[model samples]
Target: MKKAFKYRIYPNKAQQALLQVTFGCCRFVYNKTLDIRKKAYETDKTKLSKFDLIKKITPLKEEFPWLRDVPHVCLPQAVYNMDAAYQNFFKSGKGYPKFKSKHRSRKSCKFPSSHCAVLQDTSHLKLSKLGLVKYKKDREFAGVLRHIVVTQESDGRYYASCLVETGADAPEPQPVEASTTVGIDLGLKDFIVTSDGRKISNPRFYATIDRRLACLQKHEAKKTKGSKRRARIRLKINKLYVKKRNLIKNYIYYVAKTLLRESQTLVMEDLNIVGMVKNHSLAKSIQNICWGELRRVLEYKSQWSGHNLIFIDRWAPSTKTCSHCGFHNSTLTLSDRSWVCPGCGTHHDRDINAALNIKRMGLASLLPAVSGFDGRGEVGYGLDEASICTV
Candidate 1:
């Protein structure tokens, strides 16, 4: 198993300067290699592998002597990272490699284990070029260090994320049962509504700070660009953004941890968040809810905890269909929060109904294949049988 531990690092002025140079060098290497690979493929349909790109770094250093000033190991790692991006592009048919911008792109660089180490005191970290830098180690971690990535955030805070191999086998997933299973419907009104009838209210972290952030931005806009005042205001705005993100992250972690601790098989909708955010009216709210981030956290944590995480088809009519009587309510509008099922006279809460349907859909996927099991049945197609099997 592999785990990552992140800690804030305080680098001296000289170390910070070197870190900035290392970040620039790494970005330059990545963008230059990407350009080379793109042109090679476009002109002659040639492919450049990781090693091939690494071989070019030597000549690149000869051409640009400043590249030699940063740690040598980081340069090759940059090529490796670019190669990975290209490979992912080819595999996914999306996310083509793009040039990293000095201002917009993330300021980060990777260092191999040979060039990085955590000191015995655990309060200091040693890197090849940058000597021992002090860091706040919040928790103890035991593992063989694989690598470390140093990142400088928008607010000028620096952190180190250390990846380590724990050398432990992951627990096997437990069997799914109705009593132990749960379904989650993520929403803006509420953070989540579970099949078990639990509703966790959305904290609306962004909304809480929206007015203040807007005020800060307005003040920042009044300042002249490239001026000290503008820079100070910009830093303040960035810090606020960081605070909002941290709040949301911590809340989601708590929610995910609670769910995984209680449920054996967790089911959720595979929402198309990219498409959902297209609605101008809901874009800001949707982004603030961080549905995608919550799902991502649930996925990895479930795997780590040996729990089953299930995502039903994105097209599944969890919202429109009646969970009680298996009736398809095609007329159910987005504004309809509560609806009475015409088929069975059952009253349903929209989110809870959707959650139940999601749970049923997930359990249906685990059913043994049979002649009538088409796998595309409606939300409550075989609810009775599933309930029986789960019991």
Candidate 2:
């Protein structure tokens, strides 16, 4: 398995200058090569491979001598990065690769294993051109180093993310049973509501900083552009954003860890988050809650821990369906927090009922071949026929 460990690095003035030059060189190479490939394809329908682009780096250095100032390896890595982006576009029908701007794009460069190393003392990192940069090693990591990506954030902080091969096989997935399985519904009101009656309150990290963030932005807008004062205001705004992101990341990790620790089989609705965010009134709240980030964390963590993570169909009517008697409430509105099933007279808390329905549907989907249930109906695997028709 491959995992990445990140550490904050403190570099001297000279090293910082060198790092900035390297970032510019890498960006230049990437953009130049992308332009070359794009023009080739357009003019002659010719396709240029990564190696072809890498071979051009030597000629580029001869033409533009400043490129030789950075480590030779960094240029090729840029080509590789561009190649990966193109490959993803071709394979997944993703957006076409666009030119990276110095001001708008992320400033970063990658170094292969041969060009980067962690010192034995664990307090410093060694790069080909930037040697012995000091870093805060918060924890020890054991694995074969694959590569390191050094990045400079908008807040002017430097971080190095080291990718390593752990060499440990993933654990075997446990059997999915009724008692061990759980269904979760993610919402803005509560971060998560599980079928087992657990509600993890939404922290609303962004809300806590909204006023300060707005004030900073307002001040930034007033400052003269290209002035030191404007830069200072911009930095402050970036720092505020960084702080908010970190808070949300930590909280999401905690929520995912807590849920995975209890359940072996975890199920959730395949929410159309992009569509949901289109609602102007809820967009801010939706983004701040980060439903997508929580789902992403749960996915990878569940795989590492041998837990089954299942996502039910997006259109499965989990919200309006009654978990008790499988009664479908067609008239339920978004404002109705709790509703009583007309058929079974069972009262339901909206979110919890949705979670329970999601759980049942997921379990039913897993056993469709044996249960004779198509997994599309409101009534799930074990529901009695009489109860299913009660409505």
Candidate 3:
């Protein structure tokens, strides 16, 4: 397995200057190589190979002497990244590569395994060009170092992401008890409502900072471009944004961890977040909720922790169906928080009822394809018993 561990690093003034140059050189190489690839494909209907772009580096450095000031390894890494971006675009049908801006783009550079080394227990990293820089190593990993990416965020904080190849393979999930199964209903009002009638209140992380963020943006807009005042305000805005992101990230991690710990089998609605965000009135609220990110966190964590994570169909009428008597209420609107089921005559809490329905559906889907089999059996054909933990 491959994993990345990131840590905050504090570089001296001279190192910062060198890093800035390295960032610029890397960005320049990426953009230049992208341009070369585009022109090559357009003219000859052929893509520029990584080796072809790499061969140009020697001449490029000789022509532009300043490129020699940064680490020689960075240029090749940039070209490799460009090749990867192009490959990803072709493979995934993603958008075409775009040129990176020095001012607006992310400042980052990758150092290959041989180019960088970490000092054990010294809390320092040594690079080919950049000398030993102090970093806060919260935890250490036992693995072969693959690569390191040094990035400067908008908040003016520098971070080092160390990628390592851990020799351990993923563990297989154990069988789960039916009593520990849970279903979660995500919402703007309450972050998560469980099938067991537990409601986790939504902590609007962005809402808390929205006013200050808006004020900063408003002031930043009024400031003249290229002025020091604009730069100062921009930094302030970025710091706030980073804070907001951190808060939400920490909250989501806590929620996911807690849920996974409590539930052996977890089920959630497969929400269409992109389509949901199209509603202008609820866009801000939906964005702040960050349902997609939470789901993503749950997905990977579940695999590692040996938990079952299931996602029900988005179009399922979880809200309309009664958990008690399986009554379908067609006229149930979004505004109706609580409703009495016509067929069941049971009052249902909208979110909780939906959660229950989702749980039932997920468990049903896990039922054996052919009857007379012992235990839960295989979760339908094409899905093996061992792979049911995967989302």
Candidate 4:
């Protein structure tokens, strides 16, 4: 098994400057290569591969001879990544590659320069360009380093992620006795309301910290673009975003672990959250809950613990399907939070009913009552077009 451990690397001022220069150079090369490919298609049908592009890099070496000694892997990795981008485009059949937007800054670069130091046992980790950087977090890792990826964040944080091969320490679990299976209904009002009368409210960390973030953004806007003041403001905002993300990730891990520890089987309604976020009123709240990420954690955890994870179909009528009596009320709408079941005298909480129906569907899936989704094949992406069949 491979595990990743992240630590804050404390690079000195000089090291930070050098690292930034290297990062800037890498970004320049990546953008240049994309331009080259774009021009190649525009000029002629001839294509340019990494090998063809390496010759052009020689001119770059004359301009920055220091880069020539930087190491082979670092530069080639960028070219290979560009190739991979085209590969994925064809695989997904999601139309032609669109030019990356300035506002939509979602990409990153890697440096595999041999000089890029591995996480070693010295007082600090030394990189070729960055020099020795200290850390407070435990680097006493117990795994062999398999691969390393050095990422330059858009906000200018340098992170070295190591893929390490570690021996599994999983305990041979005792056979679980009779335990309850559960279905989860993720919502905006409540973070999650389960079939078993359990409901957790939305923490809304982003909403809580919105004022601070807005202030930071305003401060950033006031600063001259590319000035030191702008960089400093951007860095502060990046840390806040990172902090919120970490908190959310930790909370999700806790919930998923707790659920896995107690349950023998976990059932969830297959929701295309990407699609659900289209409604302007609920989009912000939905993004805050990060329901999709929560489900992902539950999936891997349940799989590791030898428990079943079932994803009821999107069209399963979980919300409208009555648990007390097997009645499918097709007329149930979003506005009705409470319902009087015509089939049986039962008061059903909207979320709870959905959860129970999910549980029933999960149970039914285990049997061969209907064509059970094998969780294989292409899954949903985009608005409600989900990739969660195997969820």
Angstrom error of the Cα, residue 310, model 4: value is: 2.7
Q: How would you encode candidate 3's per-residue C-alpha lDDT over 1-391 as one tens digit per residue?
A: 7778898999999999999999999999999888887888899898668999999889888888999999999899999998888889989887787899988899999999999987858999988789999999899988899999999999999999999888887668756445788889875468889998999887665675888999999999999999999999999999998888888888889999889888888989887765665767644555545778899899888887778888878777778877776666899888999999787577889999888777766765666531332233123223223223323
How much lDDT does candidate 2 score?
A: 0.84
Instruction: Give the number of colliding residue pairs in candidate 3.
Output: 0
Query: Which candidate number has the best TM-score?
Result: 2
C-alpha local distance difference test of each model:
0.83, 0.84, 0.82, 0.64
Could you give candidate 2's per-residue lDDT for residues 1-391 as a string of tens digits? Answer: 8888999999999999999999999999999999999999999999999999899998999999999999888889999999999999999887899889999899999999999998748699999988999999898889899999999998899999999999998888877777788889875467789998888887665785878999989998998999999999889889988888788888889888888999888988776765755757644455545678888888878878889988888677789878877778999988898999998898899999998887877777676332333444344334543222110
Model 2 deviation from the true structure expressed as Cα RMSD, one decimal place: 3.8
Give all TM-scores, in the order shown. Answer: 0.91, 0.92, 0.89, 0.77
- Stretches off by above 4 angstroms in model 2 are 276-289, 368-391
Clashing pairs in 4: 275-383, 275-384, 375-390, 379-386, 379-387, 380-385, 380-386, 380-387, 381-385
Stretch of 10 with least lDDT, candidate 1: 382-391
lDDT of 2 at 389: 16
Residue 6 lDDT in candidate 3: 93
Clashing pairs in 1: none
Better of 3 and 4 by lDDT: 3
